[model samples]
Target chain A: MTSRSALLVLADGRFPAGGHAHSGGAEAAVRAGRVKDAAGLESFCRGRLHTTGLTSAALAAAAAYGLDPAALDAAADARTPSPALRAVARRLGRQLMRAARATWPSPRLDALAAMYPRGAHQPVVLGTTALAAGLDAEDAAYCVAYETVGGPATAVVRLLGLDPYQATAVLARLVPEMDQVAERAAAAARQGIDALPAASAPLLDLTAEQHAAWPVRLFAS
Target chain B: MDRVSLRATARIVADADGGLPLLVSDGPLALRRTRAAGPYTRVTVVGAMSAPLGGDRLAVETEVRDGARLLVDSAAATLALPGRSAEPAAYDVRITVGEEGVLRWLPEQLVSVQGSDLRMRTVVELAPTARLVLREEQILGRHGEPPGTLVTRLTVRRAGRPLLDQELAFGPGASGGWDGGAVLGGHRATGQLLVVEPGFAEKPVEPRLLGENGAVSPLAGPAALVSVVAPDALAVRRLLDAALAELAPF
Candidate 1:
């Protein structure tokens, strides 16, 4: 059986994967006036959960399912159209590779680090890390799906000085939908890498590129 | 249910005078070769009848051989209207650019009317040295009504490698949150411009924000992609037109 604690460790906000530096486009949305208060954050998070969130979860699950990492990496590149977002994924992947290798000491993670050097996509690395941690595809999916929204929620509180309770409550209300999204992602991974979701969030993509050009910003992406 | 099936093909090869050597069109898609100032060959797609309603299958294929430059555009915007049949309409566009060849595909907008469902896919194959400038504009709904259902997938490959492949869905029946804060954000008009140039291999374009609603960034390959979302078709075109002029690297 997989270690349940490993799953929590992977999903914890304090995983030290360099995720805190990025707001997953939340910083840009706030500047655009698209997300202001707790309610606005919930709407923004919901939109992200279904589009890029679902797509990232599926990739993580496929990686955990033992799909070819190189192929999954290419697929991740295809699914992400914005160059700014692509850079962010690779940066996070590199960081996660370091932590996962030290914690789990797996040959698979070592080989992946050698192959990418810089890093593979974060979702792909997350999946391999899940494997090293003795977790399953569903666990990996849950970790990624939650992070997809969790990163932004945590950042929004700091960016707007919103109530921490309100932010936690927003995530609480989305538990049911997040669970469904995670389940769907894991099931799709069983089909194959080609079966992964390619949903696009145009506004997020646009805002990310816009955010990358910002001279002053709170988050990396 | 009976559905209309139309398959159109256009072929072009370099001629002695840099003209079109072979051009073909069939079905409701009539290809009209128009004269332009440049040495490149230009063609316009003139719709012979109202088409692409529900249960309809339409395909357009174009090939630009080596040493040839071709430009293609449509006469007017294509409307996706509800039909008697419940099945969704399908439109497939395939384009191939040979070595050192160039292609410019600037089709008109595709409007998704209420109660209609349409699925469109565009696939492009380019040789290592080939160049391409393609634009896609989509309007979710008319003036006051809500959009129906529209789904589009674009797969572009350069030298047998994926450059950009994405799928977008809008209106009813799409996954939840498409119109929410992070997705469209209640915008009804959206589009993208993709320009692949060999020049970018030496020096990639810097990421830049276009006006307020759009942005341009370099892809992994020797190309650039500009994405835009606006409140109306006019605004979308304005941003995309400006982007195309600034970013199109021949």
Candidate 2:
């Protein structure tokens, strides 16, 4: 049986994967007055959960399912419209590769690192790392789906100085939808790469590009 | 279901003296080719319908031969209306550019009226040395009308390798996420311009906010994709014109 603790270890916010520097676009939303309180935060999380969250989860699941890593990486590149986000993904992936190699050594993981010395997409690396850790595709999907909201949630707390409990409550309220998105993502993995979801948030993409050009910003992107 | 299909191709041939470039095309798709001051052949649409109805299917195929340059444009905007059918209208476009060839496609705006649904897919294949400048514009609805459905997908490949693939879905009940402040931010008109060239350098261009609501950003690739969302079609056109002036080579 796969170790249940592996999921926890991977999902922990303090895994030291360099995800802390990114706000997942929450910083931009908060600055624009789109997300002020817990209520608006929940709405923002829900929107991201269905679009970018779902897309990332499916990519992780596909990687965990033992699909070709290079193909999955290409798909991830295609799905990401903003160059800024793409750079962030690769940076995170490189960081995750270091942690994963030390935590759970595997030939596949080593091969992936060698192939993409610059680093593959983060979700792809996360999925492959989950595979190396004796976990399944669904487990990897759950980790990614949760992080999709968790990253932004933490960012909002820092950016707007909102109540931590209220932000936690926003994530708690999204548990049901998150589970649904994770399940759909894992199922889509079995259907092949072409069948994967391409749902996109154009505003998020535009804002990401805009945010990258900013001379001053708290988060990387 | 009423369906419309168009197939068109453009090639460069030797002139009577075998000196200047002569543009030739075939197929039912309308073509009004004119020689510009430059080496590019300007092809404008003629005898085509102004709008598409429900269940309408359109297919346009174009090719630019080696050492040839072509530009495509339409006389007016393409307005999609709800037809008598139960499903949405469809448009499929395929384009191929040969070695050292250039193609510039700047179609007019596609406005979706109330109760209208339109699905469009464009696939482009290019040689390693080919150059392309393509633009797409969309208006959700007529002023004061409810928004309709529009799903657009673009895939570009060079030497059999994918360079860019993007899909956008907008309309009612499609995905509220797209309408969120972080996404489209409640804008009605949107435009995209893609420029792909060999040995191109990344330009440090910031996303500029046009008028009250429009903004443009340059994406990554040998291609630079500029997207803008505005309050209206005229505003979007102005934003696109400015962006194209900065990004487009020809």
Candidate 3:
């Protein structure tokens, strides 16, 4: 079980995982008119959590439980099609690794740091990083779920110019769904990646590509 | 879609008089085939953003048997045409590669045209020793403009438990499916996803990151699952290279 304090920290938006730097595609979604105010943002977040979140949570569990981090990492890499976004994962990964190591401090973290010297995606690194930090499989799964949606929700506040309260309301409403997603992910984590696979939507795929070439950068991607 | 069994609508007949099927026959999503052994059917698959309707949906599901292999291409760079009714275009695709079956599901970028509403579900189940290669491309916005609003959902499940389930609600803020750095980097314009199973040229499976374009995660196994989401084919190609390199390894 993950301590409530640890869960709070893991769930915190200011934990320095470099999550703030990413709009979770919110900027691009806004640019595309796919996401507007908090309501629209919620829908986008829900879609992502349902599809992409489900996959990432499973992979994070794979990393937490000691599955081949490399294999799960590879799968996560494959699932993310946007080159710009992928670059963001590696960069955020490097940043999070730096942060996790400093906050937790451990040899296993050292091993992962050595594995991907440049950086690992937040999911892959988070799975193991949470384990190293003493978060359980369930907690790790929750972390992945929260991070997946929260990043964009935060971005929604900035991109849509909605009231922070509105953003918080939307996120709060998604809690039940997030719990369901985490539960499903936790279940898959027990089975391993072979027993589990991921599927993602295609428009998001193209959006990443389009966002990648944007001359001006709002988010890392 | 438990309400629907992928097998109920099986075997796409190519011709009469003991001929192959227009679409491949699939059993529980895996590969299957029955050949009178003649010239097989060929179909081109291009990009599509919204769910296909009428003949277009049929085009999306058209298949050729083992005795059949399609050189898939696109029709005017597929677009996600908006729907007139509330129902999104539903695509149910089943492919069976018996002994030596080959079906290529490839297409150009799928552009989600403005005011397009779509829903596509592909239930593919491959046998233990089956071989397959499928490519799915989807793009948002028409001519660089985000298509007004729509709901495009994609779900692919194998052997029961769930492989991929995606729902893209583009209308008001009512849909909740995909978001996060894990997928589109929180942007919206265009995105494409590609996945392939085992059976490619032999290589030392060492999955490595190729260009600074993105990161690569190397899979260690006989099966390879690759996905590249990009705004255009070029970016998808870059992602494909990194993914292939990672999946095939050195």
Candidate 4:
């Protein structure tokens, strides 16, 4: 049997909030000759968990562990140099805050919402929401880790190139890294987002650039 | 009483003799090329059609056969003529990507000038194990022009699960005027993009430089979709078409 709390966390599509609309750049990668199929997807997801997912996980843990909302926001923003990434972080954060506040009420969450006008990022908002929900710091880390990779998998399946099983398998393979990233992300949260290290992936960025020019497209930036 | 409609349909046959792209590996980059500017190759419409000058609602559809690649490009910047609320203009694009087939459906940008009510929708369906690369961009108001209220809805799905869907409604400063941070962010230009990587959803690839006035996010999965609403529709369209060609033969 699953805990009602945890069930709501995963079962609700809104929990991921506008995640359905994003490809995590899967479309871009497949289009660019990088990711081909299940094998390629697995390789890509693992890499993300190690790099971007790792960074995002840390930020999420920090948010859960009670990091300064302003500091976390700036840190996540600065670390994600790509304007597209930055926009995504904020867009997810802003919308998440709106929904979290409505569903799970908390004063701390309110304080975080106030911070958005000042440019708060999604991970930080997510962290505050986790804290309000009484979730442990680890939960935040895991959620971020899972989300960073999970999003693209869903998008790919929706795009009709991979089976649901193949995408889930990719997630399952990342479990080990998910554990490792949880630890590292939690530990890094102590040092703050600025001190955190990041390995930027270039292929994703190129695909995003290419996708931005279509006359008739399916996603919103 | 005057009414207008423009429809474009194209079919691509792979191995149509060796051609550009120099890549012939199960790639059928069949395309319908329409001249939009000076000294460019042009394809005539098979039948029923009318000149598209913005404001006029335009509809487009493209299909790729299994093991084929379809590439579609346009001639010039699509301008939306200003119209009253009761007589707004619209444009529609429908597409299908078959199994092991590739479709790079990239066209020019849509420029929405002042007093123009433009409605556009794009629907895409992908087969099981199919692949596609697409691009799209929109300019709210062109050349520092004031952008009044705008409406647009876009949808993409595979096996009937929504991958990306967007709905935007705004008027010249919907967020309490242009200076409001709630809207525009004072950037004057906006864009949405999709990069479809079928297998790798959360894969983090490096962001690419698309040129000035453009930005790229990290790679997400096997398929990525983006919406880029920018300042000058012309500049964005020019950038997108060139990029899609390089992403070919399929």
Candidate number that wins on DockQ, 1 or 2: 1
Query: Residue B42 error for model 1, in Å?
Result: 2.1
**Candidates' TM-scores?**
0.92, 0.86, 0.60, 0.46
Residue A79 alpha-carbon offset, candidate 3, angstroms? 1.5
Candidate 4 lDDT over residue span B76-110, tens digit each: 54556554335455666677776766555555555
DockQ, candidate 2, comes to: 0.44
> Better model by TM-score, 1 or 2?
1
Best by lDDT: 1
Top-down DockQ ranking: 1, 2, 3, 4
Per-residue lDDT over B86-134 for candidate 3, one digit per residue giving the tens place of the 0 to 100 score: 4454455555443334444544555556665554445454433334455
Superposition error at B54 for model 1 (Å): 1.7
| Candidate 1 local lDDT, B1-250, one digit each (tens) | 2445444544444442457666666666677888863767788888834667787777777778886788888898888877777888888888889888888899899999999899998999999999999999999988888998999988888998878888889889787777877999889999999999988999898888887778887888898888889999999899888888887745
Model 3 quality (TM-score)? 0.60
Ranking, lDDT, top scorer first: 1, 2, 3, 4
What order do you get sorting by TM-score, best first? 1, 2, 3, 4
- Candidate 1 residues lying further than 4 Å off, grouped into runs, are B1-27
lDDT of 3 at A54: 75
What C-alpha lDDT values do all the predictions have? Answer: 0.87, 0.78, 0.58, 0.57
Enumerate the candidates' DockQ scores in order: 0.69, 0.44, 0.16, 0.05
TM-score, chain A only, candidate 4, equals 0.88
